[model samples]
Target: MNQKAPEVHPSSEWVQRIFDRISGRYDLLNDCLSLGIHRLWKRAAIRALGPVQGKHILDAATGTGDLAIRLAKVGAQVTGVDFSGNMLIRARSRAPASLGVQFVQADVLKLPFKDHHFDSTVVSFGVRNFEDPKRGIEELWRVTRPGGRLVILEFGGWMSFKGFTQWMARSARLLGADPEAYAHLIESSCSFPSGVGFVRRFLENLAEVKTQSSRKIFFGVAHLYVLNK
Candidate 1:
């Protein structure tokens, strides 16, 4: 008999434990599984986020501080927040004192900062891990100053890439990727709405925000969203 896939509960505590367990190898798995293309995607997202020099920015669900490091390198004062202490420890080890990135242990749904505190906010491959994705987004909006932007990079199911996605998902383990983790990721991506569906939901929860969908990456295996408040 075929075995049922394990349920993926993206509660904050559950997600924290998952990252804590995978923290050591998380970066490697990301590099391998995406065939090292995530770097390009991340770079693209950062560029589209506009200038951040001398500004305050938040990198929520900042696993291992890759995005945080990039933001700091560009002269932004970056606060990278993650619930997993282990993940933050790895991030701290990799981050130099000169990098100017602050790694904090905090829940994304209830950010410790005051409202309208950040000049910009960004999350890559992180929002879907939220137990309440909408609430997670609302918190982002709460902290971003007026006229600031929110940028996100996430897995997407593009119509033309249906067959390609299937093939790629099958090829994941061939790259020595984490099979169980990728399984949950693929399931979550497919179930998460994108395009118009995503826009409508975002508009509902966030007031006075403008949104634009960017070109999908690798045939929509991932998507970029820019929301300006």
Candidate 2:
């Protein structure tokens, strides 16, 4: 919710540029599109982190550093890693001065850090964009300390709300999102890892896993996964 503005959706090559274009307009669009309920979803994701003081936190795919800032606010020493240079630039420019947060431009598939380096890791609405989510999940697990936590926030499918799906699609289209984009949103969620599937994936690699999902303001889907290494 506190993430910096977003850019117009763009291809992988234009990742940085796309985020930059939407950076200034990002926050407003999010609130407008989701009716300000994203704040609650973010809060829920952060809550799953429990207490974080003095812990080292990694905010992977930290677009605009919103989760990093939130982690810092809770007394964690936060490091934000992202692939988009412009996104990092905007994060650096807008982040709170005294939060003790650092930003790094790095690929999630190959994080430039030692194994088991962080106490906790987080990614909000960032995994869907990964070229290889399994590799991305592995990278998160790799950098995380044993017994540490990894929390991810992403979209959930609309299957549970079939009656309202059409209305929701129309609503998104009216809110400045391209119809194709909204359709892609629906399709991606349909194929994305479900709550149980995600837990199964975690069971294969992580120590303990817990999950919770919600609909944000009748406009967006939010899924939170907490994995302890």
Candidate 3:
């Protein structure tokens, strides 16, 4: 018996709706699905950013504000942005007032901000969600000031990808998660470029695009790349 594979949405609107529907359980699912290792991965990405005392940072696609909160703690003025309103609401509600982490609803493909506005930009497990990843990376560098850093943490795509991301969706489904949402998720990750290939594309329109550091985590399931603009 042959079963049809699940379909992933092509529209960004469908993606937003999926995130909104699962925004409440997003954080818990992160802890459960990744077995809390995501926190460690995120920390490693921040560490790659080096010192951040008084630096202005942007956390793109910052769902629930986990990475944004961490960036704020390191003395960086952080602005976390996402297009999903429900995700922003959760990020705002969970973020401590004293942290002063600003949560805004915005699309990554076309950010609404002046050029070179941030000292550095960080996206943790988020860049893959952008409808246009190359544009999103360019936009990240656009807001980043000269000598600024861009740190991206995402799932690696150069490995055996068949059924892996789909298997992830199945696991999440067993826990009462949205299979349709994760089917899209798996599809996106499989389609997203990472590490070296992504670096070449990310540096296409930038000057002095330098990689400060690179790391592979969990046996190359994820990668951390820090670029200087």
- lDDT scores in order: 0.81, 0.70, 0.80
Model 2 misplaced stretches (Cα beyond 4 Å)? 1-20, 159-190, 201-220
Q: lDDT-based ranking, best first?
A: 1, 3, 2
> Cα lDDT for residue 78, model 3?
92
Which tens-of-lDDT digit does each residue in 115-205 have in candidate 2?
A: 9999988888777666667678888888988778888877665433665566556666666654444454455555566566755653355
* Leading candidate by TM-score: 3
Q: What is the Cα-based lDDT of residue 34 in candidate 2?
A: 58
Q: Model 1 scores what on Cα lDDT?
A: 0.81
TM per candidate: 0.87, 0.76, 0.89
True lDDT of residue 1, candidate 3? 35
lDDT of 1 by residue, 130-181 (tens): 8787888899988999899999888775622577558667666665545656
User: On a 0 to 100 scale, what is the lDDT of residue 226 in model 3?
Assistant: 83
Model 3 alpha-carbon drift over 4 Å, by segment: 1-9, 158-167, 211-213
Backbone clashes, candidate 2 = 5
Query: Tens digit of lDDT per residue, candidate 3, span 17-70?
Result: 889988988987888767898988998988888788799899999988999999
